[model samples]
Target: MKNLQKILKYALNYKKYALLNIISNILSVIFELVAMLLFIPFLNLLFNEKTVIVSSLPQFSFSKDYFEAYFNFTMNQYIADNDKLAALYFVCVLVGAMFLLKNLFRYLALFFIAVMRTGIVKDLRKDIYNKILILPLSYYSEEKKGDILSRITTDVQEIEFSILNSLEMLFREPISVILSLAVMIAINPHLTLFSLILLPITGLVIGRLGKSLKRSSSRVQQQMGVLLSTVEETLTGLRIIKAFNAEESSNKHFDQQNSSYASLTLKMTRKRDLASPISEFLGAMAMVGLAYYGGSLVLDGNSDFNGGEFIGYIIIFAKLIAPVKAFSSAYAIVQKGAASADRVDAILSAKNPILEKENPEILNTINENIHYNNVSFSYNKSDIVLNNIDLKIEKGKTIALVGESGGGKSTLADLLPRFYDVSSGAIEIDGINIKNLSLHGLRSLIGVVTQESILFNDSVFNNISFGTNNASREEVIEAAKIANAHEFIIQLENGYDTNIGDRGGKLSGGQRQRLSIARAVLKNPPILILDEATSALDTESEKLVQDALTKLMKNRTSIVIAHRLSTIQNADEIIVLQKGEIAERGTHSQLLSQEGIYKRLSDLQTFSN
Candidate 1:
């Protein structure tokens, strides 16, 4: 329920629509209330039961019963002067007019509610998207991709059609119930009290069901996140699944989750559906009790209500049924929405670890050298991955990192861009610590290209010029030519306009690497970080990628992480890492002269090739 209030705060964004919805719905209730109350006078005119023809209008009073008696006198005056047929016609026209106005306002109310419903959905989704963008990359590492996606898509949709629409019912339905009850009490006070007493029993039954609904709804939402995660992982690894002939196993896993989701959803729906009938049954029992008790009062002449007023009181009580049921239904929906709201707020409320410093230095370039001063890092802090490492690379010099797997080569390179901050110590560019620099400005000076090309499902032109927001087509072509990608790109069906499919699947391995280089070239940053860039390609593709990488690395301070020892042989300095510590550091030739780890590694690779 607290979550519901928090979610409703978003309704302020589209307040005009909500205000109109409230005004129109309130008008509808007023007109509908008048319409229902008109029945007593209308019934009197038709039956001609109250026949004392009054010469003047009845004096109004402050009492709650004044409107009831005043209207009764006015109708009796008309009935006394006119024929029975004419009086009946007059009553029919008034009843029809009241109903017509009532429905018209109801339609207008619905129109404004529809606008608010869609508007709130749109705003919530946009907020989720914006939050996703600002959240640190580590958030995705700890969180499930599909769960985040489910919150953005399915959970938001549930809030829209189920919860947001319930907001309308919450406001409008109570007004209806109040108006109907007020009229009933005026007509027959004793009968209205009899109906009100049984309401507590109805509330207890519905309240129990509502509590269960929230728990079941939360389970259903969690299962949906898992279900979507299965589909997402399956799509990402579809080729591996097919190649390994594990389709049946994957299908079995998915089916199990799907079945659990369906079962949980069934439980929630069943619990929510119980509210209507429980309230309805109890309401009907009270309605039947009022009918018998009110009839006896009219027969014994112990009450002010005659048969016509008694029947009209019952009619107004009957009108209370729809609004009471609607309120019950809306309550159940709000309980379910609270579950989803908690899930959504979990992401929205997360604090980011990689935040920029206040009044931080803005870096335009690396002037002197990039220094790693006693730097160490760990993914989970238990086992340190990069130990108290100290190194420096002068501006415009290429530093190569070589090591066995899990030696933290990639992690070391990642520290430069602050993808993951060091567990201890600090990294600095020139004289300033990286932490003291603005993240965007610090990263703008560096470009990264990984082994697995991270291209989007877009045109080659757009992919190449991705971050260079104002890059021209000529610049894209020039960058491509420098990376040796222009020849292949121009041969494509649409050339620069050609779509790259998912993750550049439309291009060959070498072509894809070249496009990555082209993107890095266009960004034209002063510092470049290459993480096993040519490791994934065959010898032929490696040669082309290596050549393009050489062009991209020209005059740029570059950090190279290479698995193949032969590719980085020309680096200005080579650092060899063993386990989580740096074992050796020097130029390739200088390290070879040492005949230590570098020599052994170079010998092994040379012998294998």
Candidate 2:
């Protein structure tokens, strides 16, 4: 219910629509009630040809008797002035007009609600996407991508179907039931009280069924996430699966999850489907009891309940059954929706580890050297990835990090932009702690090109100008030329406007890397971090990418993480890392002459080449 309330909070954002819906629904219910009340006078006309007419106008009051008296007086006057048929015609026209107004207001209510319903869903999706963007990278290391995808797509759809779709029933039905029940109490208090007794009993039964439904629905939603995760994994690893000829095994695994999900959905839907019929049966029984009691009163002559009024009361009470049953079904549906709300709330309420200071100072440019003061980091408590380390990198210096795989080179470079905060010490730029600076201001000064060139399915121009705002066509082309991507880009059919397929699959590895470099060049940050930018390319692509990287790194404070030793031979300084600690630090020539760890690594790579 807490999660359900959180979802309803989004409705507060569009109060005009909600208010309009409420007003329209209230009017619709009023007209419907008046339409039903007109049937009483029609019943009198049918049963009594010489019906007794009230001679004078009745005093106005709020009780049912006064309105009934006034209505009778008006009908009597009309019948006397004309004939009974003319009076009946007037009543029929009035009833039709009331029903017409009822439906009009109902349509208006639906019109207003449609805007609110779709608006709430749009805002919810926007918030989830924004939250995904701001969450620290470490959050994804433990969570599955498909499960998060399920929350944004499938879980939100469940909320729309089960909760938002019920908005009409939730708002309209209750008002109908309340207004009808009030009239019932006015028609006969004793009978209305008897009807009320049956409701709580029906509610108790429905409540029990609903409790298990939420639990079952939650399991179904979770299984959906697992099934989606399996599908996502299979799509991502299709090439590997085909290479290894593991299609049979993969299919069997997917089949098992699919079967489990189907079973859970079947059971949950069965429970949810039970609510409507049970409410209907219970309401029918309550109706039978009310008729028997009310009929006894008219027959025994011990009460003033007449045949015509009794029949009208029965008609209104019967109308009440439909909405009551609808209410019970809506309750069951809301229970199911609550399960999905719980899943969405988990993400919406997730705590972000990265915190910015309220009045953080701006970091527009680097004036002096960057410093890593006694830095230590660990993904967890026991497995430290980096030990206490201190280093300073002067502005405009190309400092290269060389090491074997899993030696914390990438982790060290990642810490500079605060992808993950240090576990112990702090990193500072221009003598100011990075934590003391605004994230946007701090990151705006740095550009990163990683081993995997992250490119989207977009035009060559848009991809290059992704993070850069208001970049013109000439600026984008100039940036591509600097990264050596302009030659191939112009050869394509649409030049800069050509669409690069998913992850830039339409382009070669070298082409993708060059585009990544072009994007960095366009941003033209004062600081650059190149993480193995050419490690995955062939010799020809490597030479092209390395040349562009050299141009992009010119006069910028660059931290280069590399595995190919030859590429960093001309670095101003090279830091060799081993076992999460700095093993050696010197110029490439100086380290090779030391006959130490750097000397052995350089010789090993030299031999391999």
Candidate 2 local lDDT, 262-334, one digit each (tens) = 9999999999989988999998998899899889988897787777778989899899888888888888998
For model 2 the local lDDT of residue 158 reads 93
* Top candidate when judged by lDDT against the true structure: 2
**Model 2 weakest lDDT span, ten residues long:** 44-53
Q: Pairing residues by index, what is the TM-score of model 2?
A: 0.98
**lDDT computed for candidate 1:** 0.86
Collision count of model 1? 0
Candidate 2 overall Cα lDDT vs. reference?
0.91
Error of 1 at 191 (Å): 3.0
Model 1 per-residue lDDT tens digits across residues 1-609: 676777888888878988887788878877776766666666664566755445566677866556656765666676678866776687668878887887898898889888878887888888889989888777898989999989988788778767887988987987788777777766667788888886667767777787788888889988999999999999999999999999999999999999999999888888887888888998898788878888888889766678778877887777787788778877877788888888888877788788788999998988899999999998887989999999999999999999889998998998989888899989989879999999989999999999999999999999999999999999999999999999999899999999989989999989999999999999999999999999999999999899999999999999999999888989999999988799999988899999999899999988988
Off by over 4 Å in 2: 48-52
